[model samples]
Target: MIEVRDLTKRYGAERAVDRISFTVAPGEVLGFLGPNGAGKSTTMKVITGYLPPTEGTVLVDGLDVRRDALEIRRRIGYLPEHTPLYPDMPVSEYLAFVAAMRGIDASARASRTEAVVTRCGLADVLPKRIETLSKGYRQRVGLAQALIHDPEILVLDEPTTGLDPNQIVEIRELIRAIGREKTVILSTHILPEVQASCDRVLIIHRGRIVADGTPDDLQSRFSGLRRLSFGVRGPADRVAEVLSARTDLRIADVSDLDGETLFQLESDADTDARPLLFRLAVEEGWELTELHRDRANLEDVFRSLTSA
Candidate 1:
């Protein structure tokens, strides 16, 4: 559980994060999305106690991030965009070092290290130095260190960066698996990753939250325009006349191809033109071959929100 209230972060006079507020419930995976220089990483740093807020407050499980920085860090496992790691240390040795640094008891260190090693698929690379591992494995080592202490919250920034498609899928599944138990705030620009692994999305632009919701919720909310595409067997003039009579529907394009008339209709905002079109076709005795509505996807929503 995490809460951010009117949080703002500044460097000198430049406000990297401005008055944004949101909450992440337990077991939820929140995707933090933004273009470059949008302050996503700044917000995460404030939440994880790596950086202090210029204004507002952040609370983790009811503890204030400013006053309880150490306590909050104990509950949070953070993997920054540029993961800090000891490249010279072996995977197992690195994990053990992190566990000890997190104040894990001497007795629990061995088991905890092994648990994270297996959880993050680091077993095969345990004896190898971190520098010798592949990009994907290096990322796994970063995640393993983050989870070595078994924190309640995981703050991951670009956890899948630089990995190939297969490795990206593996990391996405791992993050999804972790989200089953702990609250996760995943910061990345990849819209599909958010769609595939995150439960909800928060889009930040110019230091402010531009959009917030589930993938479908956002698609519905910001999908101001809707397109209806259909094909019918009928007189093109009569079809155009019938559709033209409806002021709510804007006929974008109409064409006749291979004796079939195709129509593309646009509405200023989301509207059910299907019912009216269907009724008109039925009344005109037109044979409807196909009908469908095109809705916006997550990327469309992102561009619409973050674009200039």
Candidate 2:
């Protein structure tokens, strides 16, 4: 579990991570999302003690990250966005060095290192130097080093950033497997990553958290402002008046496209207004081609929160 309270980080005159607070429970995969310059990395660094917070506390499983920095570092695995690896070192040699640094004993290092290599799919490249591997393999090596210590919490910054489509899917699946027992806080710009791998989302914009909830929760809350898109074959100019006259339906806008009428509408009635819209279309003898509700998605929420 992780807890952050009134977390603030400042650099000179600018506040990169403004006062913010949130909690993550064990076994929970929380997505940390934001646009460029949104303070996501700053917050992660503060939590990991890589950068000290100007004003606040971060607790990992009841141990203050600052006060118990060494212990906290032992209990958590951090993979920064840009992984620093010795290019000349072979995969095994680099991982062995990391295991030794984590204080793994000589009696246990080989088995532990082999487990991580298997878990991160680094078997084929164990003998290859880091510089000879592709970006995906290098990323896997970074992840292997992070897990080489067998930490309980994972703070990953853009774990899937430079991976190809297949590599992304593999990493996502790997993260899901890891989430079965460990708490994971994944920071990324990929919206689908949240939908695919996270149980909850923390959306930060302008150095503050603007939203936090499950994907469905955020979508439903913002979807109250709905739009029903449709096409009609009748005169476009009359489309607005025809729908507006209905006491139950609220027409947002109507436009003509290639001689076909388009309606963006909402309903105030207790029931869905689609049935009423169709009956009215039939009565007026206008051809009805399409009608579907437009529900809000994560992308919509991201745009609405981040856009000026």
Clashes of 1: 0
TM-score of each: 0.81, 0.80
Question: lDDT (CA) for every model shown?
Answer: 0.88, 0.86
Give the per-residue lDDT of model 1 (tens digit) for 1-308: 79999999999999999999999999999999999789999999999999989999999999998899999999999999967688899988888878878999999988898888889988898999988888888988989888988999999998987889999999999999999998899999988888888899999999999998997788878866677887899888888888888888878888888989999887765567788778878888999987888644677688988898
Badly placed stretches (over 4 Å) of model 2 are 225-296
Residue range 31-142, candidate 2, lDDT tens digits: 9999978999998888787988889989988999779888888988889987778999999999999999989999999999989999999999999999999888898998
> Candidate 2: TM-score?
0.80
Worst 10 residues of 1 by lDDT: 292-301
After superposition, which runs of candidate 1 have C-alpha atoms over 4 Å from their true positions? 225-296
lDDT at 32, model 2:
93
Deviation from truth (RMSD, Å), model 1: 4.6
Q: Locate the minimum summed-lDDT window of 10 residues in model 2.
A: 266-275
